[model samples]
Target: MLHQQVFKLALLSNALLLSIGILQNPSLVQATPSYKASNSGVPTQSARLNDTLIIPGLRFGPITRTTTYQDLVKMFGASRLSDHDVFGAEGLSRLPGTKVNLGETRSFLVAWTNNSRTEVAEVRTTGSAWKTQQGIGVGTTLTELQRILGEFEIPGFGWDYGDVVRPKQGRKFKYNIPILYLSIDLKAAKRYPSDYRAVQGETTILSSDAHLKHLGIKVGEVRVYFDQPGMTSAE
Candidate 1:
């Protein structure tokens, strides 16, 4: 009985020491319900937040105008984000931006208001996954855009701001919300030189232009600009 008691005490002591070690070193502790690791090894909570809805003129996932670089790093693992200089419209200037997922299909660019990267000036994405609540996104056809936007205007092609959508009057989205700048480009503008020529350079081409259907135009990129003071127009 004495020997059995000693063995039991030794086992209990070893278990206690192991528990204490785990408490002292958090890395050794098993994942709790609230702190589980995702398949990619990032914390599940952060990974989940990264998939938040993309609301135009509002938020991209959990990211907003107030979101910072560190906030992005927290939502998306640091390994997935890299800093780079994004060229302003027409290659006029270079602005600091964060490239998320880089070359991946879901990749997007977040341009900062300043070098500090504490304020997001805008978010641009060509990924179809990042769609507005109205289901507008990259790959949305001209007809589809017309259906959603209900008579918008696009800048003429073959220029810096070519193909960018603009509100005909004041911000006339069919939904009556702030504009989400979409760059819709013809799949093969060069194929139909006449059609291309008709829409090139500083001209405002109405979305209802009957000729646009033959050009195979689609939303190539989507940009959400935060309403920041001194914020210039979308390029």
Candidate 2:
């Protein structure tokens, strides 16, 4: 009986020691949450546009405005991409569109310069997950955008009748580029009569075209672009 009790005590002590060992293990104690992002305030790979800050001249998620196309490939792993030259600059500028996970954002466009593969000129995205620090995202309402971004202007033509807001601070004159593009869905315009009227008042085309007048209004997509050295007005 004594031997059996001693064996039982020894087994219990070993079990306790093993539990203590596990509790003291630094790896186990320091284990991080899988969902947390490496950079605080920076969004995770799966974070939505409004969930992260849109720091112009800085970065978006894992991609910085200055991050090169080659660097992107190295960071995100191999991705199928298409490359082209800037519309007017030709050889001077290279634009590469990559198919990578942009959370809820729809597109990822990067531009490089100096005829180099690693020179990143700009980064643009229409991802819904991409947003300004003010929480204005791709799907944010026009009223909300106007409220946060103040007055904005809409290009009279093009497939995107989105309004552009140039922020006065946080990356202003450093890059003479559109900070945020707020657009509405023409198809959904009829549903939002007030927004439809707002769009009509902003652009003459919508008001002039009787058929297009019926278009609806819902925040369409948002695009954020960085300014590079050689880019001209045509780009």
Candidate 3:
């Protein structure tokens, strides 16, 4: 009878341990990051690599005529920027310029090239696959993702931002994970030759990438995909 009691106690202890583990591992008991992102949080790091991938870009408007962040403020008066990075560089394309700096001004210029045309893309990330995955809870929402991640990296696109990312949810899927879609709109730019708009656009993308790569050891490559309106005035 004593032996039987010990065996039963052992079983109870094992059961208790299992319960504790499940409770500790929120993902196992609750939802996965992917699931949470789909439901309400940002996309998980895994979704970017293992699932359909797309980098986020900014939904830009004509700011070319405006030369400085101050100029932007004059027109916008604290208007909302589409949470994304507007940047560019030279080494990759051999453009006769240096590195692009987004932080130079809250509002900066972005250039891209289309068949000898130069233009810029306001890059944004919907949600990057984390350098590693994180636990997710059941009631995760976009607001929650913003709280935890604060910022995200886009895939194959040379842009990212802290504020622009918004979370969305849709129909459920196999893993019961919702699909999270984020926008990566290249800012809309209009041409004005007579006005002579001269804002200092970012010089190089390399520096920004370096910063992110350092920020997250396992983060992936950074590249910008933009529309080229036409080449800048040749030097």
Which number leads on lDDT? 1
Per-residue alpha-carbon lDDT of candidate 2 for residues 188-209, written as tens digits (9 for 90 to 100): 6657555456544323332233
Residues 1-235, candidate 3: write the lDDT tens digits.
4433543353344334434444444543222223223332323433322432221121122222112333333333334332222333322333221122223222223333322223333222222321112322222343443445443322222222211121122111111111122222122112322211121121112212332222212222222223311101101
* Every model's TM-score: 0.69, 0.51, 0.20
Question: Alpha-carbon error at 106 in model 3, in Å?
Answer: 1.9
lDDT on C-alpha atoms for all candidate structures: 0.60, 0.43, 0.26
Sequence-dependent TM-score of model 1: 0.69
Report the number of the highest-TM-score candidate. 1
lDDT accuracy of residue 114 in candidate 1: 92
Q: What are the runs in model 1 whose C-alpha is more than 4 Å off?
A: 1-52, 176-187, 228-235
Worst 10-residue stretch by lDDT in candidate 2?
226-235
Q: Taking the tens digit of each residue's C-alpha lDDT, what string does model 1 give over 24-65?
A: 545322222233555634345544444634544456655568
Backbone clashes in each candidate structure, one number apiece? 0, 11, 34
Model 2 Cα displacement at 93 (Å)?
8.1
lDDT measured at residue 186 in model 3 versus the true structure, 0 to 100: 23
Better of 1 and 2 by lDDT: 1
